[model samples]
Target chain A: MSNQDQNLAATVNTTQGSYRVIVGRDVIDDLGTELQKTGLKGRAFLVVDEVMFPNPSRRAQEALERGGYETHVLALEIGEANKNLETVQIVYDWLADLLADRSDIVVAMGGGVTGDLVGFAAATWLRGVAVVHVPTSLAAMVDSSIGGKTGVNIPKGKNLLGAFHQPKLVLQDVGHLKSLPAREMSAGWAEAVKHGFILDAQLLDTFERLAPQMKALAGEEPVAAIRRSVAIKGEIVSADEFETGDHRVLLNYGHTIGHAIEKVSGYGTYLHGEAVAIGMMAAAGIAERLGMIDEELVDRQRRVLENYDLPVRASGLDVDALIEATKSDKKSRGGTIRWVLLEGPGKATTRRDVPEEVVREAVLAILD
Target chain B: MSNQDQNLAATVNTTQGSYRVIVGRDVIDDLGTELQKTGLKGRAFLVVDEVMFPNPSRRAQEALERGGYETHVLALEIGEANKNLETVQIVYDWLADLLADRSDIVVAMGGGVTGDLVGFAAATWLRGVAVVHVPTSLAAMVDSSIGGKTGVNIPKGKNLLGAFHQPKLVLQDVGHLKSLPAREMSAGWAEAVKHGFILDAQLLDTFERLAPQMKALAGEEPVAAIRRSVAIKGEIVSADEFETGDHRVLLNYGHTIGHAIEKVSGYGTYLHGEAVAIGMMAAAGIAERLGMIDEELVDRQRRVLENYDLPVRASGLDVDALIEATKSDKKSRGGTIRWVLLEGPGKATTRRDVPEEVVREAVLAILD
Candidate 1:
């Protein structure tokens, strides 16, 4: 691990808008200065996940206040179940009580749930207001925090209600992950690893090389992995902010199946990346069977996932139930499910022509 | 009443996104042709206001189906009270039941409530889907429909939840206004007349010239008024789609007090335009006191509003209550209320420097 002093920044420029992602060790120490640069003119409301308040959230509040910002911290109990319109109203009430205006800022600090919840509030408050994200978890840092996708879930589905609101900035403090549990850290790696499979071969190589010490995320390896993953995501989002083109869909390499798994097992049963890890294994299985990739590549993917202690299969799951779940996925156009398949490491393709029988076989094979 | 058989179209090119506003007599007759031109693929879901189904909505559905679209009409009972997340969910259920894809289109046909409701659903469903609007009332055609501002109300306020999802197109059929009650049609004119007060002197002249027959709305004059108003809104939105600058704030010429009036009077007591009419009067009074404009101009504004039968004052409202309402307005910057005051007809300015004592006097004068 490098533990270098300098910060790494990735700027995403899109037709919709543009912003930057900054990742570094102890980068959060500069939170106040960085927020001042976003052109936010009024008071700051720090919406933080309750559990993170002791260290990350409190530090953020102190830094923002130190920078001459009148700050208010709203601590929320966080979980998948709490990510809905009800929770958003609580934040709205806080803003209303403060008479927060368009010039004021909402700084979301926590994991994916907190960002999505606070981001949605900012998007709708006064039609819209500026929002900045300080992601405390790896899953949020590399994926959810960078895309400017803010939303809350309804009972019908996850992220069923949301808007494409770009954040003013996304601050990823790699040191924050030190407080993360080993299992949670490994689950977050699934997205970074999937980024490797879909966009960067060198990223895949780095993950493979660091597989043995994957849980030791205190140093440079974690930051490097997150930076590279975020850059790949930033580039893709810049090209297709609305997901209108194929480029954005390619980033969903494992989401089609991953989403269904999460839905079938019940949303909170598996961490999002855990589902993606298994989904990637299933997708690789299908790709290998179709000869899109050789058996060696599939073996490597499975080995890398296993080395990180992530799940590669779902036990006792019904293929038919899984198939039913995919139909409801937002990516499925009408009756056809668009699958993002791996042709080889770093080479992914979105195919809508995969036979249903082949899909069923792949799911059945991965059901353990 | 020109009833002349020519189509009028204005193409709105905004930095956020662009779409067209089409107005003509029997334009609903061309519903099928326009939807085809939007380049949308997949089935169409016509989310209509139930009251409009007997005439306008059914007409739109038939036209779309005739144009070779597989259309499903979902009629909803409309009102300000129904504009909430609960109603949005019903629309989502309809889309889910049919497995609506990103390729599928949602056509919102009716007035502002329908447009806001269906548009919000379209904005969030599957993260987003393409939506085209056919506004049946003058308010929808001139204001809400063109802005791409789609939202549902929360208990706290109107339009408290929404997204800036640009429509694929906006179609306004002038003939539909014939079915509207005389009061509703007149109420809608307040917004159009407002455009005249803030941006276009010619538009204000058109309203004054057509004042006698405005309630009748029998011909070319109505379509022309709508066309001009839409164009003005289109132009303003193009320059400031996100409302980040002073240009977009100009469009809120009367909305500050107008929104307060709506809030204090209760949501449904006065139509939106009616509240705006009174709000404009209050703004004009303040402008007169500030010597930004003469007493004669305020009187001219009052006469024009009276000619249209729109209220220029609220007889019994409390000044303190109205002032309190203004503080919570979205335009307010923390404790300071930003009022859009007029220098004269065709000239408006957004000011945050108005003394509280002056605001109280203006409200007191307008209370009866």
Candidate 2:
């Protein structure tokens, strides 16, 4: 076998439904060969985020065309602000006018937002159709693109509108990260940190040890780090694809507050990874305040996040607006906020009936 | 226990997540009892279609209020044309503004269109709030409401923007059908006929025998027929909620061609059931032409559909337009149409690549 094939075999595995996640550098080069394996028919509709369209994604589209797939480009606006029911319709209309069928595959060739919106369209298009994700951003590569969490945002909450539709394959090319902005790359690191916090204490230590390298964006380790993070998410999702039990809910560690922050900030004010970074810090603080964890652990987390310049504190935002947003969080039940708190490293649990005052205190303490 | 309660219990078993299909007269009176079972907190957001707002649904709403659930009515335009992303956003904004929480439930009180639109809103509201379906129209009562196939239409196709969000309860009051238009009632019968064709041959014979009763909108058996048909759809969906296998695809027996007709004609040109009626006839013809089923069965399906005044032919529609619409069908894979053809009674298989010429011949024969 060729060197590239050997690398792929080491990095990815095909499951029962033939769903696979391909990881490595220059993975986009193998798009045509992978599409052939999926047995999908017709042309490939390349749905990308506006930010990634003119740069990193062009080569992938050209490769698809060269592979004999009829290709159409549906460039969507980037960020969570555009991840809504309305935007989903726009992409659907474009594909419909193109006469896309089940034989065709929708290539989500950007970050989390693009992957989610297009994947949702693919899930519902013609009942459903095949989808291949070529996640271009760090967050997309490490987290969003792996789990099959495809959906758009509802005005009331993020990802409120979606389905559990898995992709035919996910091609993560680390080369795409070279084009990502510095802030976006830092945001993506938050998810990698999240993986460590929720499942692997050792992974957290690894992040701390590699903080200097990750901050400098140096070494081939980022690709390997991202692949490991994605594999962790994949294992969690595959065990409970529907989130019907606690396994999937544990993955929501900082998201309960993180989503509220995004919603109140109108989605784009803070990048998802940035907001999640602060939210995780707040959660760790709350756990400490509640005597659930030690102060040293919180300090450790804060120091590690500081290395990447991720915000672990909130300031200059309307506190009441944030509170209101939290109350409106999709996770709220009977008007009570549900916080997913870390009991210790690599362990988490959802704590509902969390007092509004206690939550406010947590937010206030985190404000600069 | 009340007489209706005892009667319902005899046929339907309600579980923790299981909803009830309330059939027969004055069933709206039980709305209060059903709401109690939904575990809703305080009030309900009652979403109704314009047609039903002035009729039986208003009575149902009154009944819900009397049963002690604070009620708020959200009246939406009727018909498939209005089931879109824009409408869902409007509902989301309204619900978010109201601060509706998980303790609250969205009561979708209308036909299939309203149920689909509202159910989708509920599914996305706060990541998903409890939903209770009060299906007034026969089509919804027998099919849409029970299956939990909640979604809105995208400009590209029908139900292309949606989620498989099951409702907390399904309240089907067959008594409400007395106010329905004859064409509307006939439209619903087509889906019931589809259920029989897919699963139970004896049910098909029963429908054939009761064709006159169905057309005249007479007899108590219509309620029983609706209950049985809903149960069949419920069982199929419950067994394979994601349509990952053959069992659920059988539910699309006539839908492959029916959806094409709907798209070509525009969503509201004909009621969904009406299109399905014609599509089923076309499918039967194709089956017989392929020598997969006896010609006598095709005639039987035609007679049964005709008795209900359902259009069994594609006459007057442009053949090319219909074919184009069929090609855009959600069931098409890799640019090839996947037709669910009946090999015999209660036996259907997905047949791909049944030549375009054969499909055209069937279409021409039906048009004739």
Candidate 3:
């Protein structure tokens, strides 16, 4: 209703469902207020990541209680390694034990892994209930939290098991970013920077100009960058709720190689954003080699990633392992690895006919 | 398309997606042809239930192969106890090993449990893929197969963990119903019969007339019954794809008590339809006490169920356990058990304000 609320929040409409993503400083208090608007009167089961900053998690619980909700908080000590069906089972059992019903809400307050795990449990428990996401990490606010892509990873791959369950609301408090380590904060920037590469050149320019200040979460630049990134993602997802069309795939500009990097190097080695930073480099290289983008654009993309202190390449990478990992990606359908390559900043396309040799070369060049 | 193809198949449109449920004698052979029509070209990974009649499962595989599909069969030794996240994990591991891609189809061949487990796997595998269900059991063909609700049970309850993943096609061969023991066939009748009670009075009349001959699976009556049941389910699901609206809850006429019976007695103790048969009686008793239906109508309903050899009551039941189990049903919202009570035969209403004492009396009357 107020200007701040309008500025801080964006509504995402998808074929599956629609939800609002509110991003701003000290916005955790607004979670209870937003949830109340949906008219979901039930006990709120809050799932928080124990390893991260606990202040916001506690505050979120208190706020919900203040808003006349019977709040129950379950602090989970989970990371990428534990982000599998095993974790989903643990959460499902807990919810069942709590006598969680259809009207009850599952509030997932954590980073990408926590959101994925909790959102998934919400998606399946009682055949899905309302899930409100309080994404703490930057990647989650700009990407995972906006779209209803909830899933868990298996031993063989990342996000191999998931569902297209849209959230009831996504309350993103930018203040949470201050609690993250600098590296973790910057890792989130890689995805925001990616939005620039795929869809918004001016937003990419904002990131380039604020590369140094972005790491500090200071000024209006970081907030503006995040808002722009969320908008880009929200638009793409609205067009193709499921990945059945090309519109959604463009949002995966760096994810193809990024996911492979995370898989081959092990999930914990690099933050998802860091992997995508390197993946973006590889994708840029593939684009340049194919004459879609100039060498200067490729270098600019690499430099922007480096300026944010994110890794543009990995050391000691096995070409075969990366290739094999890419094959396992959901994008590599019909036995062909489709690459989302940038023609230039803010312009991207998905191609399945990328020659294997070229893909090998591109992947090889990204390794130290 | 032949006259039988036009006559045998019914189209189900849902908000999530749309597919056709083809029902007839020897319809299993038409699997590949129907799949081709959907424009989904890929290798078919057939997931078969090794227990119970295997002939239909094998025949289904051969038919797909004959229709120019490269088929792979994984026969599962599964039952109610095995239908959990653990089974889902095993299936996921197998699909991962087979290098199953997003475009490749996962064919679920068997009854409800098999369709459910396989369908859940398909729902999550690569964040879902094309799944075609070949329901060999009567309950599955008439009820579970038509709806996109796929899930597994947890330690606490049945189908507590699942997803709303619709099938690309449902191929139901009446011939497979013959392999079912007379009991299984009758259990399926309970659901088809419930359809009569909830939405179609004329259909109920047909069932009453055919009650003596229904168990035989002979003549056109059984086929017509199955067809009418599918149409009822298909229409309800199309209007309320997700159970957010009242239309979908109408289909839960007997499921409230039926699920409670299965949960209290343990899932494997009774076939789903058998439990629903008892549930129908309980619901009918509740309806009669509420003055919604007269004594003679209730007796008529009981007589028809008896004629089909469907149980109208349970031998032993814990009133408290049944009540607790009903509270956990997906329909129960805000800790209130919403009963889908019969206004009259062919008319039902979901009521949450039904006196607790009345519900207990209804349960007590059905228990010896």
lDDT of all predictions = 0.83, 0.76, 0.85
Model 3 spans > 4 angstroms off: A1-3, A320-325, B1-4, B52-54, B318-325
TM-score of chain A of 2: 0.90
Candidate 2 backbone collisions, by pair = A103-B333, A103-B334, A126-B330, A330-B126
lDDT of 1 at A41: 68
Candidate 2, residue B91: how far the Cα is off, in Å: 2.0
DockQ of 3: 0.72
Winner on lDDT between 1 and 2 is 1
Between candidates 1 and 2, the TM-score winner: 1
Best by lDDT: 3
Candidate ranking under lDDT, highest first, comes to 3, 1, 2
What is candidate 1's lDDT per residue for A28-128, written digit by digit as tens?
77777777776666888899998887667887888788778999889999778889888988998888777777788899999988998898899878667
Better of 1 and 3 by lDDT: 3
| lDDT of each residue in B214-234, candidate 1, tens digit only | 667666686677788988998
Q: If ranked by DockQ, best first, what sequence of candidates would result?
A: 3, 1, 2
Maximum-TM-score candidate:
3
Candidate 1 displacement at residue B225 in angstroms: 2.0
